[model samples]
Target: MKSKKFILESRVKDRVGFQIERILENEKPHLSQGSNFLATIGLVEPFIGLYIKYSC
Candidate 1:
């Protein structure tokens, strides 16, 4: 079986991972530079399955 870290690393190298990172990076500046709620929501939004599924 593949190790968990290896699996995670591989996933990060693939299309979905790259797209996700791209989305967040693009959106990051709009939220706010130094606010708690903005930061919280920004990170939380990506985990919804629909977002990931539709985003790519």
Candidate 2:
């Protein structure tokens, strides 16, 4: 499996909302202010472990 790390922008800070924004910003096209929040954020290992009891 591949490492699922954020492709962080040089300009953006590494934090909750900004991390989510970076994910969306790297989409095939581009980002606007009104992009869907749910789609942008993703689940990575630490969060998955905190949320679920079983291995994925």
Best by TM-score: 1
Give the TM-score of each candidate.
Answer: 0.36, 0.25
Q: List the residue pairs that clash in candidate 1.
A: none
Cα-based RMSD of the predictions, in order? Answer: 17.3, 18.5
Q: Write the per-residue lDDT of candidate 2 for residues 4-45, one digit (tens) a residue.
A: 333454234557678798787787365444355634554355
lDDT of 1 at 10: 88
lDDT of model 1 at residue 9? Answer: 78
Model 1, span 9-47: residue lDDT tens: 787789787899899999899766668887888888878
Clashes of each: 0, 0
